[model samples]
Target: MPAIGTLVDSFDDNAVDAVLWVDSYGTYSETGGRARVACTDGYSAYASAAAYTLAGSSIYVRVYPPAAGGAATAAYGQVSLLSAVAGTELGVQVNAVSGVLRCQSNVGYWDAAAVEVAYDPVAHAYVRVSEAAGSLVWATSPDGSVWTTRRTLATPGWVTSSTTVQVRLEAHRDSGTADYAEFDNVNTLPASPSGYAARKAGLFLGFF
Candidate 1:
């Protein structure tokens, strides 16, 4: 189990905190209280947090649509829970080009389990992945208050067997133009009586 208090970054410091994350690729920085990733054409970028146990915990991030300098043919923002072992991961992403939100799990490939719907920036701004008691859940929220479950599945062997997992933020673009994505309120909360609801309540109350 992790500590009682949640780990969070509002990105107000104008710098990616090295203590909280490892910049994995591309250009990442903090500006105006949000983590920003600049992705060049036909490229991707991401950052990962320090490893931590996921059992009985929830990880989430607020993702904004990609902002492009020109006609955007393809772009998206994603949040993921990743195991150290290859091919073990779960993620949720909002596609700027397709205008859809998707949740997927990977065993060896990304098709293990998946779900998607038309994306609504207001209603699906926040994406979350949680683990509890042997099950994994994917959900989305507008204001990080009310949540709608997207998918749920039995905990994968790789995840159940791992000691810790990392949370990742990713941005990708396939267009001819460069673009960027913004993320905020990257949070990992421990188990609570009310679970996600409790966390949201605390967020509104400034208790997180």
Candidate 2:
């Protein structure tokens, strides 16, 4: 990645996710110019689950200027979660404000490795799989093939038993919300994918 203040791109495009720099998070200066990682509990705050677990990739940082703010800006960041439930963490978004990359916590939903929407003849619950961002909705039938039309769930920090359940997980961005724009090292969390076979998948099949 380029050095600090190397100018990845201007704040012309609309809000976007993905690491801007391959090896570096750009700088965002609301108050000053100094690269720093800030969070509620530092980096690597994670959640827990009875079935699946939570995990995160290496923290990726990017800077987002006011898009209209004028001044010598050299600030940026990465993103992460808000609450560590020791159970579940939805889509945790992080961003930078004033040179401090703050971690956005409590962004919940059920982020899982694999998600499929199937009819629960027992509970009568129609399932809907989706990403933490609310897009990327995938539905499955009793056969995991033919699917029905279901809506997407975009409610952050929320999961439900409605048509679209919030169990499956995928990476997402919290651009619409404040304090969740860019994350620093806070993006990296404990990966809980290992329990998929025993916890997650088993939990699924168990639901006759």
Candidate 3:
């Protein structure tokens, strides 16, 4: 089993992981102690890095929506955890749009909707996902201390012991207007608040 612990990237060092821009105009960079994505062409861009396995993991990040620009059309950013890095991977996309956090988990070629959370773009929001109960749990917090549960889903088939996962920061715009999103305090923990240690222990025991 993967070691149980916590790993975090605060982005205060002005650094980011490998960047993949879906549009030539899209760019990823670190500015003002945060990882930022500028989708100049209104296309999509993902700044990603390999993260801890999900078997007993809780991933956390703070996301800020794009600043006002362009058509004011649909422009958003997301915190994603996926079984793989490719487009074909099965995982969850936690997208923040219109002051709300929306979740979509893909299974094979289908998309499953999870619950939504009230989020304010003007103010940064703390987002988290945990796999402590052998399933996926989504939550959000205003101050990082009090987290509100959003949704839960059965573990996707692609998320298995042998398959690895990644934490990704994504930005996209519907029009060719300059907009950017920021990400901060990206983290992966071995457990969540309650019952995680025991839950993880049972999962580890199951492999024997």
- Highest lDDT, which number? 1
Q: Model 2, range 109-183, lDDT digits (tens) per residue?
A: 334332222223322111223344333332323322245433334434333222211121112222322221222
Q: Rate the local accuracy (lDDT) of all candidates.
A: 0.73, 0.26, 0.60
> After superposition, which runs of candidate 3 have C-alpha atoms over 4 Å from their true positions?
1-6, 17-26, 42-46, 49-51, 68-73, 85-97, 108-112, 121-124, 188-208
Tens digits of per-residue lDDT for model 3, 58-89: 76777787743553455677766656535533
- Please report how far candidate 1 places residue 32 from its true position, in Å: 1.2
- TM-score-best of 2 and 3: 3
Task: Name the lDDT of candidate 3.
Answer: 0.60
lDDT of 1 at 133: 90
Better of 1 and 2 by lDDT: 1
Tens digits of per-residue lDDT for model 1, 67-151: 5445456577877677786766778878777788888887674764488889988888888887889998888888776899988
Candidate 1 TM-score, true structure as reference: 0.80
In terms of lDDT, the poorest run of 10 residues in model 3 is 16-25
